[model samples]
Target chain A: MAEPARGAYRELVRAQIRSQSQYRASFAMDAALTSCVSVLEILAILVLFRVTPSLGGFSVREAVLIAALCEFAFQIADLAVGNIERIAEYVRTGRMDTVLVRPLSPLGQLLAGDFPLRKAGRVVQGLALYAAALVYAGIDWTPARALLAVTAPVAAGALFAAAFVAGATVAFFWIDSGEFANAFTYGGRTFGTYPQTIYPAWMRVLFGYGFAGYQPALALLGRPDPLGTPAWVAWCTPLAAAAAWVGAVLMWRTGVRHYRSTGS
Target chain B: MPSAAACPRPGPEPESGSDFGSDTRSDTEPDSGSDKNTRSAPDARPAPIPFRDSARAFAALAGAGFRRHSTYRQATVAGVFTNIVFGIMLCAVYVDVAGASGRPGGYTTAQLVSYVWVGQGLLSVVCIWAWKELAERIRSGDVAADLLRPVDPLAAYAAADLGRAGYAVLTRLLAPLAFGLLFYSMYLPQRAVTYPMFAVSVAAATLVSFAGRYLVNLSGFWLLDIRGPISFWMLILGPLCGGYFPLRFLPEWAQWLVWCATPFPSVFQVPLDIAVERTSSGVAAATVLLQIAWAALLFQACARVQRRAVTRLVVQGG
Candidate 1:
């Protein structure tokens, strides 16, 4: 069962790549533009830090690492489930009916179909920023710390992917819930970039403990929480990410069950 | 007169109506009264070359745009909610940065809160993401009909965008301001003239923004797929326009670069400064003047681009 699903996914991705390759120039231009935009977004934070070296008690370099980590995770998740952003359109246009009839799960098919190679540009940029952050942040690279660095983004990516799925699930009810979901998915990405202590108490609780991107980021950075959370809490990123993903999948299943075809 | 020349294809054989074919066909034939109420047909009668008539036409388009955008009640509500949420988040960030200093980058906590709220409110008003309509029209060749219309396409689109801005101010703007005012210690300008100045500055900034967006969408004529250009514009505009942070916080050299090289500060930052009373009256006046100047320059540029685009379309048999 897994092998067939993996084969199907591979074929879907390959087909998309082949079609996209025909418009190589257009694709390259779009990818370059996206990367430039990502770089500039990082530049905004860097420029801000020029005036004040510290934000929420983290140095500029440390803050950049957090941002880079968030961006890295977001890019990976976006590359995987970015098509979830189009779930509203699918629901409205009755495309969901077509996906529902397939042997594969709608969510899996959507993820496979929308896997974007263009986002590799952003991922590369994230890596560069992450490297710079590591150099400037002056971390002692113990074996455990290095392991945390390697695993943090994957865990963070899983959480972000879960957020995307949850957002898409909302489309089963409200076709225009994209913006509402953005309050979580994009909002979470932005929230994770900053030290969690900077937010209001409610936001810190909602994003840090409830959503779980912040603790993971802090953990990966080997920094204790500015809000004075336990140091051991950082290690819980993978567990938190797994829990969120499971919750999101359950929500998605409920949404699918409730979904009615638009009859287009 | 150009429309006349463009229309005089031999016999009443409809201009090869592949692009915008549905629109022209529906215009010639009466509506079937389907559930989707197609817009009223364009006047087949030739337009007179009078200034008053042009003004009336512009007003009609603007009014239609205002009404059309207001119908998205859900989007408007969601937009307000998003604005409030982000506003609160950013306000907290700015407040935290202020730390014990109580004034990061020369802005008091109250002023920073007000700036975040006002910035969120004016965001849609200034940095419009609605240029997709123009780009889509261009790509679909629907702009052929638009070009053949008597009024200038640039003015028509600009006027319509101004209407959208007006509607946004009514629906999307007030809620964020109210939210910020109720929750945060927002800074209000003390001077009696400050309110009026800010209002005028905002209106001018809207025009500047519209003109810039219109030019960006015009790239669709050349690029065919304008996603790249649009993304590029947003990337450049967001930071320079102070969407992310107040331009005043940037280094002096960066401020100089923005002031001298780009009209971006006029779009969001200047109006924001006026509202926060960061700018002296003299500087506020200068900024407003600069915004108007940019609008005028951009509008002229749009006209030039439209001329070239139309020529290209005509030559290419669009």
Candidate 2:
């Protein structure tokens, strides 16, 4: 968090961007492909609506609102900290030793390393979906609702970032943990895209609260909880996000302390 | 190293890089094999290998492939866990869709549930994505060793992929399906023939999927850096092959096009339709035949492309 360390992180990101941009055509193609994947995900939701009028008691417009909010949060978090998923590789190849001996914070180095500038494509797509959903959601814009709308995705992104960081800690204990990590990191995003009531009771309690996007989305659209939870739950996203961050930070520190070199 | 254009050899054996100059200068060097006597013209290629030998080789390679996949116990467990999680999430959404509409896409609630679980099981068996072994080999110049082998690289890889699919059936395919059966009301096939037919359809689908991946990998021969194509392929295959949702959700013309003109539907949609018994027996049989046709067409393309790729093969790394 010091000024010099922050400058070092920015320089690390700038180097990655320079190397990535050197191959202009490949970078463009990757960005386009990333954008296409995001489009396909949104299309998957819309296609479900094509067959039925509503999904889990939400009309197509309302579902899109949930999906866009969840997707936007995921993309933001993914762009910010997704590279930590490569910890498994670093540990396997003994590159974690190199990462550890660096002057800056190890987590900061990992976050800044190999930053995927191309993933900005998904962020662009998410924003487009969010903008379109806002127009079609037909919400009455009070001053408070307007403020909540802007901050809601950032809170959800914070929670998702926590999920990614927490997921990366699995690499310290287990090699080849990518699949298990994806089950929650990606799975949690998919869980949040729909109304929480659709999931089984346990799934809703576990992944539903962990995602922390559905509640804010419901509040934004002015829809009552079909499961009849308290209305105050809608305002608890920031609280949930903070709690998740604290837990994730604790887990990450524990994982780093427990890390051992593969010692090839 | 001698230039390949100057030598123009008919077969893949390269004599381990010794005496490169003399080898390229001499054009009349006879091929040292029994098939040389059967050759009528000097420029003619050798006779094809006997069918029994090819089949035995295929079986051995497939066995090796199966064993290789079985070694990854941790990865298998992690993958199974992931598949079951996705299956549960997707099943919840699909149940809502099927329940809302009396029989959306002509599938009952039980049948739709069956479709979802079966599709999850088949996702790994068909292996529509996550196959980059061939491309990596190609990039690393290891594919040159494949050409030196007696068997065709296309058929050899296809057999190995079948073995991998066989392993996937036991772990990746069954675990998630059992999970679905536990929590949901799954539809049982009413007719006995559907079981055998479904098995055959799945095998054909695995072959079709392998051929598709082979073609994608072969692109590395020309493009050198195939990450772009692989990424695009991964993005499209999920939706187009019905991994995310059924292609039946598409319009009628699009469905016809997918089934007839493209090989994507034969990879996942055909086997799924057969498993759910959504189509009648006659139609189910027809879909299996369609899968076979696609597999044959794709493998033929793989063979031709492999032949071409090897002749112009430029190994990237030493």
Candidate 3:
């Protein structure tokens, strides 16, 4: 994380942005389409609520708050590190060899390679939902609560970013691991978006309710944990995120060491 | 659905269909004698490929596609695992939603559970997305190689896709369904005949799905990139095709319009409804026939477009 290496990463990202922006119309259309997908997903939730008054004891507004938080965190993580999902292709095409020879971190280079700036549309939509959820949930915004609101998504984003890294690591061991990785990465988003009480006990234990952003979301709304976890768990996002990050870094290092090049 | 660019990309125009190579002549049967003459005429239209030739090639290509897909053992396992996970999440949410509302979409809790699981199982079988092979080949100009073969590219690709679908039915479709049955109370068909009818409906649905994807891939001949159309297609078609939930969840008028106006319902809802016996026998038969009609209509469109696209490729010398 030296300054020069950090600048190199910035330059790589800038090059991608410039190339993407050069095609202004396509970029605009991609951004607009990304937003449209965001709207449709939210609509799916709203449509479900139309059929029933509540799901897992949560009203539509409450569920939207959880979903927004999870999606926001997911989008941020996806924007930051999701491109690693392409590791299968990189490995298959022997691009990983080229990446390994570079001075910069392979993970950092892969992330900066195709940054998908257009995903900002979903990020904006997610923030809009969060702001609306804040109003709709009608919480008594204390200073601590206010602080949680700002930091929750960042911490959750770190957690989801870790999930992305950890998921991508599967590719190094097994090249065709994208769908398996999605089982948690996207699956975790689906799990986190709803009240954790609705899931069977095993899912909650397996994916873990905390890293999925549910604990923090519940904390923000001051909702009691139906599974009866302590209130202190709400403040554990940073710690959980750090642990997950350490685990993911170790997993990624192991995967990198395990790599056998697709020798040409 | 429409793009600004409809003309072929600028490239060296092949002066004749002969430029496609010897396969064109070798494959055209002697029985297509008069039709063969027109193909060699200057600025003449290529004759429609004979049906028998296409059918034979279709079977072979489909088998090849099936075998090709079967080789991806790890991917199949991963895909099945992913489907099961989604099935569980959707079933949990849907069961609660259905349980609370007392059959919101006229489906009982059991029926809704069946709907969710079957939808998940069929998600890959029907394949609402994840098809970019043809478009990629088109972009790479590899589709010209397909044209160089004796078989029609449309039939060849569609057959291969059907083969892939066959592989999915054995692995992706059955695994989640077995998982659903293991853990949940699933709906069983009321009548024995429903099974065969449902199978037919699913087959037609696969054809309809293939035709839809084929046309989308064919768009690559004109557009610089097919990503926009592909995304737009998925954005609109995914939910309409019942990958999200049952179309019965839609208001009655909208549901009626979707069934009447689009092929989306034929892809998932029709077969699933038939499988669950949600509709009466008469209505189920009608929907199956409706799916067949859509399949035929879509394949006709595919053939027409494939012809035009091959012509474009020839003229552009791709």
Candidate 4:
């Protein structure tokens, strides 16, 4: 028999989506605001850009492409999984009680809620910038390469969700604040949005432990190894995060056990 | 959490919510079955720090305050990371603007890009968001509390500020620095003399920043809406201080205006200058002296405000 909780979560998603649809103007306004503002932040950089400029070793235009690539990758992280992160709150605040008592698995129900319909605005801006980069950077695009490029983001998106899940799981036991986990999840995104070569050593290690910081978009962008990371190392970057994702989940389950004792 | 300041700064009074402890105490408080569950999760959970009551009890209270705050930590973490991404996006724009073809003041496109990363990293925690611990005391009509205390109220405020500053710098400043180092080809200052100078400059900035913020916090004692004053301060301060972008990139007149008009230059420009040794040794000493002057003046202003508030209280109610 199907669990009622799963159905309820579906309803929650449906309701949120419908509510967002009803306030169409508000949704559009917020969307437009975010997109426009984010773009302006980028435009500021463009104002400072001089033509045919060399940045470090990379051309100004190439840096733009890397920037946009990371932006697109970052947006993928931001827009894709609005629900999973909130589930930690559900678990922490005793809200999970309602979900658990119902027939559905709390995780299953959680994964179903929080449809990020509005982030389309963010996506539009990111893609627009990305397209501009394509024009400016003048990269050769092919069917096979395009397919790989697309997969890079999708896989990266999945990795982002996984990181959230794992990070949130830590919050379950600690049961106080989940900001540190956010540092890894959102922090990684911010760090990743740029070419992964501008920061210092400790930060690089945060990503390098498993290509934890650099891999997802790196895979999509063919891994711009500003640090001259080995080809094999670059290839393994996304997988490094993938490992963290799985590790985080296992950690979450263990934390849940702690929560059951402490929080329940 | 009680600041005793009535209208210290222009912010909302937050008295409605109860303390976080009242929500989850397992003593006489209702023990939902969930309490038992916590007992069994040994390795998975941290033992609760027992609350105590001493002058040192404050240390525990701060710990508790942190625990109470952990619930929001997840949200804060998300906020910071999102901020970092925004920073990255901002850096990209700057990188794009500075091309191999153009270098400003001998800084190439790449160095400028790296510079934004540093600036963003700095702003995550260290900025002139003012509070008036002194002003707060005055506004609260607790100038009486100051007269009665054994130690100076100023010293008391400094202790508390240092404690909280310790917490904020970890989450806000250090975390992003970690991200920057890992992700970018960071430009580090090479000189040893610059290191000590940078430290001294940072210390000066901190003192000045503390004085300004403490003054702002004090406004809460007098104003129902501190946001107005805060926003006004931020609106002018954000750009003038070289917080939003590098001072070098702002137009020359604007840059000169910031340097001459406000305390903004001291907070940011001096530190960077010292880091790069753009200022000669004598000039650096002069800069440090200026910071000491500002700090003394602000501290004096705060004490004067306190004395007036205290005198008013004595006349009316004391």
lDDT of 2 by residue, B1-318 (tens): 000000111111111121211222222123245344445564454436545546666777777667767866777787777777777887788888887877777888888788878886787788766466677777778778777666677877787788889999999889988998888889989999999999999999999888888898898787655666766766666777777677887778877877777788788888888888899999999988988998898888988998888887887654
The candidate, 3 or 4, that scores higher on TM-score is 3
Here the TM-score of candidate 3's chain B is: 0.82
Q: Model 4, stretches more than 4 Å misplaced?
A: A1-7, A14-33, A36-56, A82-92, A108-120, A175-177, A196-249, A261-264, B1-163, B166-245, B249-318
lDDT of 1 by residue, B1-318 (tens): 000011111111111223322322332233344313222434543344345556666777677567666766766776677677677778777887777445667888888889888887888776444356677677777787777666677877777778778898887778999999998889989899898898899899999988888888888887666766766666667778877688877889988999889988888889999999886898889888999999898889988998887777632343
TM-score of each: 0.88, 0.89, 0.89, 0.53
Task: Give the poorly placed runs of model 1, Cα more than 4 Å off.
Answer: A2-5, A18-26, A209-213, A220-222, B1-48, B100-102, B128-130, B314-318
Candidate 4 lDDT tens digits, B1-318: 000010011111111133422322323232235455555664574434222212333443344444543444644465456446545555554554454446554566556544555454445334444344444445445555445543345544544444444454566556655676787666666666767876677667666666666566555445522444454454445545655455666657866777666676676556655654554777877887777787787778776765554444531244
Look at candidate 3 and give me any clashing residue pairs: none
Q: How well does candidate 4 score on lDDT at residue B189?
A: 67
Q: Residue B169 lDDT in model 4?
A: 54
Prediction 2: B-chain TM-score: 0.83
Q: Which structure is stronger by lDDT: 1 or 3?
A: 3
Q: Model 3, B76-170: lDDT tens per residue?
A: 88877877887788888888888678786777888877876777777777777636677666766767677766666776667777887899899
Count of backbone clashes, every candidate in sequence: 0, 0, 0, 61
Worst 10 residues of 4 chain B by lDDT: B1-10
Best by DockQ: 3
RMSD of each: 8.5, 8.6, 6.6, 13.8
DockQ of every candidate structure: 0.31, 0.35, 0.40, 0.07
Candidate 3 chain A lDDT trough over 10 residues, lowest sum? A34-43
